[model samples]
Target: MFQRSISYTALLVGLFDASAAVADLTADRVWAQTIDMIEEAGGSITALATRDGDNLNISNVRFTFDIPDTDETVIVSMDGWSLLEKGGKVHVEQPDYQEIVVKVAGQDDVTARLGYSVRGDMGVYSEVEDTLIQTWDIARAEVKLIELIAPDYDPAEATVEFVLSMNDAISNMMYMGNGHQQSVQSLGEMAFDMTIVTPAEDIDLSASARMRGLMNEGFQTVNFKGTPDEILAELTAGGGLRANSALDGMEFKMEGNVEGEVFNVSFAADKASSNVNIDNGNASVSADINDIAFNAFVPAEIPLPLSGGIEKIAYDIDIPLAAAPEVQQVHIGMEYLGLGISDTIWAMFDPTGQLDRAPIDLIVDLSAGVRLDRDLIDPNIEELMEQDPTQFGSIESLGLNELLVSALGAVAIGSGDFTFDMNDLQTFDGIPRPEGEASIVVSGLNSVFDQLIEAGLLQPDQLMPIRMGLGMGFVATGEDELTSEVEVRSNGGVYVNGQRMR
Candidate 1:
């Protein structure tokens, strides 16, 4: 973000010159032309707003492409009545699928406000057409910069580019038979680096997304290093069975021997429909996060001759993540059909490499069924069904809310074998998410407790709430030596307790 004040006060000295009439501008023409200009400059725009006097007021302008693209455009808010250049300030109306206003502080020094929206398709499509036709949208979303950085001496001009590091929270739904299918097998995030053009620009910027229909998971290559024991201890810490859930919105910060290279986010979708690979020095990790679909029928409202309102729905995603180190292949799969949707995902890496910046070499060999929200394209689908389930009498309604509750209920424990290619692992925080594949042997109910103790993450006396809250308990008599083995490999050597686990 470039922060400063531009006092067009000197316009009278020159700018306000012979061009007395700055191309008679209107909001519409200004918007259209803004797109033209940004595209001309290798960028695109998303929202538009105006800084009234000393304040910035945004409009209700939300735009998305037919399919996702590297949309980099600038937003110019021309008065509906005049072309008077509006003060520059960027605001985000939707960051985390939720509604919140992003405040932009700009004085007379600002030129034009810019906005960006990026989306790209990278699914395991049978053909290019399949991937192209798919449609995806964000439901509930949120994001925060929390912190940022600027170059030295405060440059002359700067523009910070913020990208929504892809699949941070994407849940996909696939078409199966007459109904839709859904899945939970997921992927990770990649942060983007912000570009600074000058010192006269504002430094505040934002990015966010909310995936509602599918599990946005793909493979990628990454390079990173961290203390072995510290990481392993954190890994086996007491976050409990719902580690993913607990780490849900947490982002990692890593320091490396490398410079700005780890700062930019690069997410690969199909990458030509191939597999992903990453090699680490001591522990590099490389694997493919394929979308596997489970077969199921999603509820859909059959439009009637004189029907009105929305429909009701319920679905599921069953996945088995397993693999071997030598091959380091993560076999992720699901069964989905017909109503299968056309979807998308986009990524923009961060300027500072403190966050996600892993090289991606993903393969879209995944075959899974997605359970879609009938309301995606049609809004009335859910309304009609909820107002009156009878409207869906002819449609197969599997009492949705019940199904999920029961399915979630059936999971006695969130225990699973976790494998990380020591070679590919970039960093180790409290611990790493259970990745790769291994035979999971759930024994002592002490999993949540033992994990924390083994990795020396938490004390048994610490709030066990994180564990018991998830409806889990120790299956062992006491904290006896619990054992589980993980067979994995990586270009970089593996580390456990700061020691090698392979």
Candidate 2:
């Protein structure tokens, strides 16, 4: 199900890419520029022609690209394509099919086909904003490939299909000032169903993605006062480009049969979203997979009686675009909530049922706050990609916040706030000099060990080293609980529980 949803995203991106490549052309002039635009994007048409009246026909339109240093060429083709100017709207459809073929050297070609169509409002321009807005509606975007043949794989018994329906999803695009700036936004819902048939199994998947709110303001409006490069320069100077996309109430599911056995999977999230904003010579990104319930089922023989899932998973990060000489702070956070397995699985691990299995859960709450010079990460991305790393950056301060975990009848929590000096590396033997301390507290530690001993998983003699290590590294803070205070001095000396280890 997730795979299908990802594919849907890719398809939408492809549609946008194709539309943006030719957005500057007016509806009245699209007929003459259609072929030219395709070629400009490195695609070729086997043949092109215009029908009498108000329609255009294109035959065997294809785009071919050769893999670098490889004997493979990927060809994407459309058959019996037509574009019509009707009632002030441009209607484009390829009723026959769209095909993709990969021809590999010394191998048979692989191919797939889909039924596709598109419709858009033409010459939608707004004088108030001095922007040319084009709106496209995808009423039918279906691909039902019965079988795709591959050289090393058998296609006689395999088939795949994709059925997508969008009733009111209107994609709005705006181009300003001779294509100097452009923006796009879309609303409405897309319904999709996909099927995959293989020799061993047949899988069916479905999903629905709907827009949650009105389109963003700046995403649909672009400034045209400057040239293309000039506009880009201005945006970069101010804060680089920014783009945001959001979806709410998204749902997906999948069911399949493997060798006559049945299985199912599904997930739902209150909201799934991503945002990228580049400003102040920095780029900040945040993504949320909120309130997610992932469940799976197998044949009764599998011995799983309940649905297991992740309640939520999310992450956020901030990064600098250019190097800064001063200490720049960056933040990162990741969290896992409500992670658990079935009680039946737990019972297997604790047959005696005296190990507090019900409380046997897993959670990771962690975040990083660090300060460092931008020069460490500052490098032209293009140039950095072409070589290997040499020198590394220095950290001024680090903060480990919200380090919490609860599992196996035990809970541990800790946080670290520390600072470092990069100039003095000898004290730490080539590492930065450090000055600060962090504390960790673990409850139910002794009780957990007692349970292990009671369960015969550990012997009394086995705890000798464990006890010695704990006595040396941690101090008893309470009954069945231990505490550790780790401190690093400016001289690079390290201590735990007030006892110097190094």
lDDT of 2: 0.58
lDDT of 2 by residue, 1-502 (tens): 1111222233235335433433333334554445555665555555556574666666656666665666776776665556665654456544534554433433556765555544433223222133343445444344444445566556566655666655434454544444433354454555667766676544343333332432321331223344555544444466355677666556677777766767777766766667777665666787666666566777656656445556666677776544445666677777776676666665666667556553333333333333433233233434654563333345677887767777667888888888877678788788778789898899998888888887777899999899998887678888888899999987667898887899
Clashing residue pair totals per candidate (backbone < 3 A): 115, 0
Model 1 TM-score, 2 decimals: 0.21
Instruction: Identify the candidate with maximal TM-score.
Output: 2
Candidate RMSDs in Å, in order, are: 27.0, 7.2
* Model 2 pairs in collision: none
Model 1: weakest 10-residue lDDT segment is 400-409
